[model samples]
Target: MSAPERIPPRSVTTAELLAKGELKVRGQIREASNAVLYCSVSYEGQDAFCVYKPVAGERPLWDFPDGTLAQREVAAYEVSEATGWGLVPPTVLRDGPYGEGMCQLWIESAADSELLALVDDEEPADGWKAIGFAEVGEGRTALLVHADDARLRRLAVLDAVINNADRKGGHLLPEGQDRLYGIDHGVTFNAENKLRTLLWGWAGEPLTGEAVETLTTLRDGLASGGPLATRLAELITAAEVDATRARVDALLASGKHPEPSGEWPAIPWPPV
Candidate 1:
């Protein structure tokens, strides 16, 4: 079976959905700068959050086929599951009146303290308390301070190779005080997308023993006949995976800590 999106309903096209069922607006729960309105979809007493991107004016940053976003996200989560990494739920696709957008699975996430509290004092964050690295002030520089931290750094490296662009402040969570859950990896592993987000601070650095082990496992897992290769291919090109693996191999060989490449301080902001 395909990886379940943890959704209230299975995938469907917007037009078909509207024709067959009625969507009771669950009120605007979230908003992006698009014509899209994220509404809770209802069908036969089932409900899920459906993002409707009305076909209209064009935005510079938004260049994706909206309908496919859900499928791409679904594929990413499936692959991440193979590696035991926690990314977000997949977006569900359906043809709509305006155009094809996505129905995203809801995530019950809180802003991580290690990510949000340190970045903005006014931002009241209630997520992910640091157990060992308690002294770290905020996430802006937490990547620097936690450079040597085992789990945090491992997440950083894993995201880097995956080319995650939206590893935002709220996308990470702590499970049972130890495991780190990373989510919303839709904008990753595309060749043209060199998105640098808040998570790039640890690039060019040496991998920790644990990080190295994880990378190594990822490497072998993406090989021919390997378990995750099929999933990785869906999120990235074969060439892309090859490049990512090469970078990982280089990091392992160096046996040094991370340093910024100084190429670009960051990728474009508000990556669609």
Candidate 2:
């Protein structure tokens, strides 16, 4: 089958296209744990590729309540937008062919991008940050590392704010030279601490000035009865929203990137 057509730059915003367009499922992204439908959305002659995750297709997890993953995904997008970093693509909660679901604009990752790597050295080289060692094969191990890119550092802060429980390497989508997008956020925003991720390179390090500024913005946006808090209240539980605010406050108070709590696995399984 022919691949879905890419969405070109257009006058209409991607969020509008996703929210109002007619979505036709092109195929199923079988690799995803939940139902991820590759689809094409069109409205007023404008067309774009998107992923639609219907709420009915969600798989129940022991920790998270059932039938809420799709809303969480949308909440993550809202938080991403509040940061003003645009780290997440345009996403909306809309009714699709299958039913109400989360629809997000598709991003075509750059094939030549190299954000992650495994090296034999015990420590990472300059310009690279070490995650930790991983078993590569029989009787061999390698140091897992990711690029010391500012984009990733921003994402790490975002993850911390959202309590992102699964920030695997595969979820990092590098687009052009300057843009990177993170996906698969359905497992985020738990009331408890569940910040599993591979972006631990800056753990315990002081937050950059930019990060502090952005986080302050997030804190204000998440204040009680604030615009962002009001929006998030619709998607996640009141407790979860309050927890998210507390996380932002903690980050701002400490003024440092968080380290592994050791209560949960630092990195996700199938790291890449």
Candidate 3:
């Protein structure tokens, strides 16, 4: 089967492509979770941007689908959305010269343009810490800090439920002090073993009234013909999503708050 002829999926959209956009953007290699090469495209009559993980038209060591990572990341974003948590927008996975590939919606570029890796295990040369800053705009000088553990803990629970393996510090974008944006979630919600992350340090801890309320809303709201269903389905498998729903039901039925389980108060590291 001539390797299933490659097809051009939907073109990306950029709000800038409209009569008025911030600036004319050319393809630039910006640093994110991993070294991401990207370009600006018009999306839905808006000046949107897409970041792509380029393949050198060759096979990787894993020898899996060439570009499948991109697709998996898209699924990651879907589950994040279902949680009503602000996360990286969705992208499409297409066939590149070598194998499967991914593309994603771009957030307003940060001043540092660097990632927030706690440690340097799976990153490029300079890493998220070393990348110097460029003034994207006037007031956007400082990098968003993950100083807020409470918020990270909340996100960690969502990551745990979704099984996000790479919820590193760098994947989070600090819009300002209070606002945060999460990205690069390709590794999530798989059928095999779950890679619960650090977002749930407060796990067995009592579920906050707000936390219980949010889980209830998500449980009641998530269904087949829902606004966020398509995105959620894309992020997780049917079995996994159903399992999350079941867990939520059990938690709510028990009327229990959230807390950490086992010896560790949080996920071994932090956040969770």
lDDT of each: 0.51, 0.94, 0.50
Model 3 C-alpha lDDT per residue in residues 145-252, reported as the tens digit of each score: 223244554565566555555566556665654446677665555543345343433445566676577766767656665555555566555666566666566666
Instruction: Put down candidate 2 lDDT per residue, 1-272, tens digits, no spaces.
Output: 99999997667778888999999999999999999999999987889999999998998899998347889989999999999999988889999999999999999999899999999999899999999999999989999999999999999999999999999999999999999999999999999999999999999999999999999998888888999999999999999999999999999999999999998689999887
Please give the clash total of every predicted structure, in order.
15, 0, 34
Of 2 and 3, which scores higher on TM-score?
2
How far is 270's C-alpha from truth in model 3 (Å)?
A: 14
For model 1, what is the error of residue 258's alpha carbon versus the real structure, in angstroms, after optimal superposition? 5.2
1 or 3, which is superior by TM-score? 1
| Candidate 1 residue spans exceeding 4 A from truth | 1-30, 33-72, 87-104, 111-114, 117-151, 173-180, 192-195, 200-205, 255-258, 267-272
Each prediction's TM-score against the native? 0.57, 0.95, 0.56
Question: Candidate 1 residues 187-269, lDDT tens each?
Answer: 66654435455554445555667666766777787777676776656555677666656655666677653444557645334
Off by over 4 Å in 2: 1-11
